[model samples]
Target: MLISRFELSVARRQLLHNRGQTLLTLGVVATSVTLIVFLATLIGGLQRRIIGDTTSMIPHVVVSAPERLPLAPWELPSATAPAAPLFVGRVVKLEQRLRKIEDWPAVVARLRELMPGGVAARVAVAEGQGVVSRESNRKPVTLVGAVPAEFTRVVDLQSNLAAGRYLGLNGGEAVIGYKLAADLNLRLGDRVRVLSSEAVSADFLVAGIVDTGIAVIDRSSLFLNLKDAQSLLNLGSAVTRIGLRLDDVFDASRQRERLEQYLPYEINDWMRDNQRVLSGIRAQNDSSRMIIVFTVLASGLAVASIMVMSVTRKIQEIGILKAIGAKSRQILVIFALQGLAVCAAGAALGCAVGWVLCDALGRIEVVVSATGRTAQLFPVANEPFYYGLAAGLAVVSGVLASLYPAWSASRVDPIHVIRGQ
Candidate 1:
């Protein structure tokens, strides 16, 4: 106990004797630790928001036909001469598009079974192109047909409505995207004409306007009753796709593989479907890692430089202690303990500063371009693990930096270090 106390006392005295160098070393360590904590918190928050926004915009897995192609005609039109004055040329043959998925309920049931939870919701959907017109304004949109209740479980359609209630599939009501409505100057209860490629036109009451916070979806898609879409597209009880939402979105690939046995359609997982957004998140992660590496390296260099200077200045004192019966191990412990003390102090101060910086970041608004949304405040993850991780890194850096200096101090020769001649 006496030896330990003596070693600690010497370490404290040495730090106090060179207060400027000690403080500078501490500041460098603190700055490195602060950057680590700040980057981790910011990146973690950004990842969550990005993933959540992207996932909510689409289903975890989508089962659909690979392509919509023209089917072979059952019977060729007769080459008989036209009986009317308007029919002067050959008759046009009708070609049917083959893309509808039959018996989707069985496939959906099998998919739900393959998921972690058997309660995962799957919805049937049919898609086609149509022109939405409100007076002179007309724009092309992708029309999606879905059952309202089932669709709500597959995506956040009901919760993100900007105006009016969600479509109940009754009274021929339809839901339009906010951007589409804005372009058409449409309002709730307003009537709009939607025409399909088959020249099927109908007046639908605008029941709701949804702002999904995604530019593409909001500007190019709208929703209608499944029955209405089937009728308009002349599809008899057939759906074009099945959307499944899982409890854990990361399991989409596994679930898709399992679902392959139940259906022959192409299965697209969310990760593959939103590769661009995921790539952005990955890029941010890579940049943060690079920053952390440089910060840690800089901190280690500062610690090493300060420790080397401290050992040089204390060489005579170390020689005196050795001549007075101090062991090399004792001298080593003194320097190591000094390094640990510096790390502890710096880590504590860095954590406090990091917290303040994170709080400030949380108050600033960030506009996510990919999502086409502006967050009121930046999201910050304040988990205790981040601080613990920063402290651990600081400890490792301090110990590694102090080793050479501590070894040099232990190897001091009394004869050479103490000679006045």
Candidate 2:
């Protein structure tokens, strides 16, 4: 029901009469909302930064040759099972082999056609395990070979370069991770010998040092020109896999599914490969939401308790109103209006304070790594949606908290209160 001017006047008078208590309750509600807004923004921005850092050095999706599986004699149509006279024995496992995608250039072209605007970059990579040595120091590393320009589009290697320059289009030039360079005591222009698993060896000048923040990549990875890697790995004209970067990283899984339907090769997405990281992010979000919920509930309970006390203290006024021509519904509306005013004021104050705090914190930067990589410690997200959400929660909490107390005030007995009972 709509509140009349008389009910609004009564509500205003009651709150003014107990100005201290009203102000205290408003402060509590405001503080709760402020906490909610700050936490939500901080957590959201943190999750974004973490996901960006993790996905920056990796391909969103990878397309490769399907895995090779060994078949038993009975499982293969060409092999006839021996007559059951001999003792049963398990089939010997086949030697592990590096599978290469056949006709990968055409496959890459097909991927681009299928994805259209979705595909940002598609680069074929020749990868293999090898050992790199500078003088006496030797370290085992994963050798990756691709066109520098194309590979950088897939994985942002150029932006993460710590020293020197990225791979040139010429042979005998290599880019090594900063950790690997450190381990081997190597520097730019230092000639290092790399021996592939196939025993093919080559000497390359350390052209670049990249610090990707990912331990695995930074510790033991090497990059070379596509032809050089192919020669070292003995892959001839074939590549180990094709990596695709999407316009939106989160679309990797959906695109992977679509690609699987269109192509016969094995397709994998970052989401599938990084299940643990995604789980951690999900947990962080859930925890932040729970914290906000509890904060709002606590504020609601505080409002409810204060309203209940107000109802107790105003029994005589309620009885007098009931004794006169005032309706029980008017008494209820007056009390509810008091709650709405307090919550509305508090929510507005809270939103203002929260925004200021977030803005101040966002300006402060912190060094996140030894390589001079810096980031905002708070990274407060200033989205209006979060502010609206916090205010909405507070207002709803206030309305619900006022309900029972308003009903109790409306039920005060005129005769009993008149007798001072």
Candidate 3:
């Protein structure tokens, strides 16, 4: 039976009789709601840190060669032709396409042409995988090639340098990420051999060390002069990618498209390259939404249990009411409303508690390792609206829990209790 005015009044009276039980159930529901919100906030903060770190180190737009199935796994011969052993990059001559966008060449030259006189273009070579050998241990490393001075113009590589000096364009030296250096037991004066798939091997003196704190980069990356990498790869004047630096980094996608038209070869921006990371983060967020649902259901259980016990204790009262001409449907309405009242109260309390806890947590400071930046961690302004969602979940659970008990209460045989049988 549906709830009625008289039944609603009775449900209210029953809840009023047990103040402590009502509050306790509210507390549990609210706690669970707060926990889920807090977790979501933490995850969001971590993602922001990763994006900030990545953008600071790499350009918003990074142009690379046309997509090709990378060289064969078992064939060293695939890296370079015999006569040009050591140069390992794909090249395309575009004399008619690029270098014509007004001042593109002057402002956006390759590494060799990049001068400190305000030019912003730079070329880079990237060897995806290699072994950094030291003593009896060999650790994997990502070897990058760039003209150090020119590269820093596009990427903030200088700020990350923790020790020594930048490798000169003409020098056969390399700069290693702090984590990679630590693993291979390298120091400023140490020398390591870089063997490419092209079978053109070369040794570079460790000139510097840098700590970016980003585990992905710090633990695996090493930088050498672009000329050195090109020499080893057998590319005399070619590079794997051309990285562009600009004033408004956020407008990279537009610039990337423009550059693609200007060049004969292919190019890719940062977002395209890091799509997997973005997708994973979004998926995790979608899954976290269920946390609030479970909390509300648990709260509903408390309301159900309380209503059931109340009905048993008031069986005689119920019989008296029935004997006085109250309908079975009336009794059912009264009990159902009581369940609704309990849920409503709990939902209100849960929402309040969620807001208080979330606000308090936001004032707390946390250091995220991914970006090496400390932040006051908390949900943004619209975060409290999520509490509404949690409360709704609890209300649904409460209604369902109350249903069985309300039905059983409605079927109570009045004559047996009223006549004292």
Candidate 4:
């Protein structure tokens, strides 16, 4: 029901008469909203930072050759009799040979067409296991080969370089991880011999040292030219896999599903490999939501208590209005308007305070790792959606909390109240 001007005026006057109480109720509501906004922004920022760091150097989706499997016993041909049932014997697992995608260029082209703007970058990679040695010091490493320009777009190798330049277009140049360099007692411009698992060996100049902050990659990863790696691994014009970075990291799983429909290659996304991290992030979000719900409910109860007291104090006033031919609905509307006004003001104030808090906290920097390798400011997601959500919840809570107290005020009997009962 719409509140008339007279009822609104009466509500305004009543609220102003008890300025201190009204302000206190507003402060309670504002505090609840502030907490909700702060928690939501903080949790969201942390999750983004975690996911960003984890996927920084990795591809969101990987397309590779599917695993080869031997035929089942039932599918085997019967040499003795064409119609006779095949006898089942002991089953033996066949070792998979070298896995490589020969038609990777066509696959990459197809991915580009299917995804359009969804894929930010894609690169074909020829990778293999090899051992790098400098004199007596030796270290095993996973060697990756790709075009420098294209690979950097996918893996961001340029930004993560600790020393020297990334791989050049020429052969006989290698980029080794800092940890691997340290283990081999190697330095920039130092000569090292890398022997592939297939017994192919080549000498290379250490063109760069990269420290990606990921322990496994930093310790055992190496980079070389596509031709060099392919030659070393004994793969003729074939790439082991194609890596794709998406515009939205979260779209990895959906893109993977879409690609798997038409592509014959095996497809994998980062989300599939990081289930534990995803679970932890989801848990944090769930806890934050629970806390926000309880906070708003507590604030609603506080508003209800204050409104109840207001109704008790103004019982005589309410009776006087009813005796003057004022309807019970009008009395109810007056109080409900008071509740809405307080909540609306409180929501505005709370949004301002929450933004200030988030901004201040975002400036405080902290070291993320013990090695002092990386430092970052506190993450605070400044999303307008959070502000809107908090305001909406507060307003709804206010309306609901006002109902019972307003109903009680409307039920007051003018005859009994004026008779001193």
Candidate 5:
């Protein structure tokens, strides 16, 4: 007990004697640790935001018919054949293999049963290409026919509306993208002519104009009632694809593969399709880690330098302590305690600094280029694990940096020092 008290007392005295140096050392450690934590929080928040935006905009898994079809060489010209049409050959009308999901309600029910609570939503969509024309102006638009009630379960398209309501699938009603509306010079109640590939044309009232923040979706997409779309596209009671939002998007690819064994369809998972975006996120994480590593080294070096100088100045005191009956181990413990004390104080202040910085950063608006929108307020991840990690790193650096100086102080010779040599 006495030895412990004496070591602590000596450590306190040394720290107090060099108050300016002690504060400087603490400031260095605190600054580095604050930066480490701030970077971590910023990265974590951005990752979550990106993932949320991606998953919300696109389905985690999409089950659809295989787009490619095997062609008969006898009916069609071979690749090596002349580019000119075979005028002598029998004329055949070009037809798209337009596969559709049959008995879709039953399929969705069966999938829900198979996965239990793992699926969040399953929406059926009928997709096709069509031309929207107003007077002389005409542009191709991608048509997505959906049951508003079910589609909302997968994507909250209603919430992103810039004008009017979502498609209720009522007679002759459709919702258009913002860019599409602008191209057609349309308003909430305006009527536009939609021409299908089958030469069928219909005039529909513009129910809503949506700005999804995704430029591609906003520029060329339109939504209408499924039954109306089927009639217009000459597809009878069939859907082109089924979109699924899972409880855990990370497991989407694996679950999609498993579903493909029983379901005769192609499955597209977001993670597999968006590898480029994910790769960019990973590169950012690597950069944040590198920054943290350098900051830790800087803190360690600062502590080491301060401890070394302190030991040099206290060499005579160390020799007297040994002569008076303090053991080498006691002297080592004193210096080690000083390092611990400095780290403890710095960590407390660093946490406060990090919190303030993180809050300030979170208030700033960040422009999301991919979405063509600004995030009004940035987010910060306040997970407990980050604080624990920062504290652990600081403590580790402090101990390692103090070791050599403490050892050197403990090895001081009392006889040589007292003899005035």
Candidate 6:
């Protein structure tokens, strides 16, 4: 039997009789919902950031032949570049034919010939850490020496410029990231000294300031001309790493397999280079999802508790209905309706509040890392989905939680209450 309007009214009155408990329950539900949404949103942003570079910025294939000799860990000309083991360029001496080269300007050449469109810009690399001085204070930065136009094709250097312009190959010019410039108190045309282990006396003019938005890059990256880099590092034409950019970033594994025919060098995608960091991000994402489930479960418990309290307070009303010949099922229907009302209302409120908060948090800044390099949150940022999922989970939980309590209310022992037993 369905609960009647009169019974529903009685139940509603009973629920409102204690304003404090109702408010307390609502507060608990809302808080749990919010926490679940916030954590999911944060993890979602991290996933988007890590995948964006690979999916959008990187290419499908990369080719590089290994050198015949052993590769050692390379130290930047300064100390700014990430510390990493050097590759053995021994395979670099091989001139094997590519059995099934798909793209012309065969990717094999990218590692061996050092020709145009090769894996890396054909030039010298002077890597090292340096401190850009600003009057009295200094900021640590990564310094790279490479040609602008060619280097940009592999990695867009010009796009990072925030003030003035990027440097040309003429030499005697430098580009500093915005954060580094801020630390160094440098402006366009300002002369800045660059010191590296390769050389004791080296300096260049600040032609531009770059803003990577990535805290690490903005504060620690400096671009120098390839000629200047080669001269400073004394590499002549030796390059430490061949950064291969493919036409399709997702197909890197296939490309790596194919490139092996011509180039003996090992080819690793960006993800491979930064597996530890990416793994950490994945673990965090899993943890966030688990937390959401527990949070929703907690909210469900609140719904149950509220219903229990509502049922307990309505014994007198139950007694009156029973005396009037109403069956226990009918009496239970009224309380169940009341429980449904609270659960549904709470779910809707929680969803709305969670969505808004997650979207707003997305506006917060995030830092992401990849390939021994770190980049700040860029254009591909998206984190709202996480919050939405959390809210959906909450709604489902609310409904499920209400069911058991509603059933319990419907099974009340009306005879005892009416007889005052």
On residues 1-421, what C-alpha lDDT tens digit does candidate 2 reach at each position?
A: 4877899889998898899989998998899889988998898788887888878888999999988765554665645656554443665545766789869889988987898897889899999999999888899999999999999999999988888887464699999988888899888989999999989999999999888888889899999999999999999999999999998888999999999999999999999998898999999989998999899899999999999998999999999999997888998999899999999999999999999999999999998666676779787887898899999999999889988899899988899899999
Q: Give the Cα-based TM-score of candidate 3 against the true structure.
A: 0.50
TM-score of each: 0.77, 0.79, 0.50, 0.84, 0.80, 0.55
**Which stretches in model 5 have alpha-carbon errors above 4 Å?**
1-17, 46-53, 67-94, 149-153, 156-159, 167-172, 198-202, 225-231, 234-236, 366-373, 376-388, 416-421
Model 2 whole-model lDDT (C-alpha atoms): 0.89
TM-score winner: 4
Q: Order of all candidates by lDDT, from best down to worst?
A: 2, 4, 5, 1, 3, 6
What is the TM-score of candidate 1? 0.77
Predicted structure 2, TM vs. truth = 0.79
lDDT over C-alpha atoms for residue 253 of model 5: 81
Candidate 3, residue 180: lDDT: 78
C-alpha positional error of residue 388 in candidate 6 after TM-score superposition, expressed in Å: 2.0
Measured with C-alpha atoms, the lDDT of residue 286 in candidate 6 is 78
Native-vs-model 5 lDDT? Answer: 0.82
Clashes of each: 0, 0, 7, 0, 0, 31
Model 6: how far residue 365 lies from native, Å: 7.5
Candidate 5 residue-wise lDDT, 157-208, digit = tens: 8777777888465868999888878878888899999997767789999988
Off by over 4 Å in 3: 1-4, 43-272, 275-294, 367-373, 377-382
lDDT of each: 0.81, 0.89, 0.66, 0.88, 0.82, 0.60
320: Cα error in model 3, Å:
2.8
Clashing pairs in 5: none
- Show where candidate 2 strays beyond 4 Å: 1-18, 70-97, 112-121, 148-150, 165-172, 189-191, 199-203, 225-227, 245-262, 282-286, 314-326, 358-368, 375-385, 412-421
Q: Candidate 3, overall lDDT?
A: 0.66
How much is 39 displaced in model 4, in angstroms?
A: 1.7
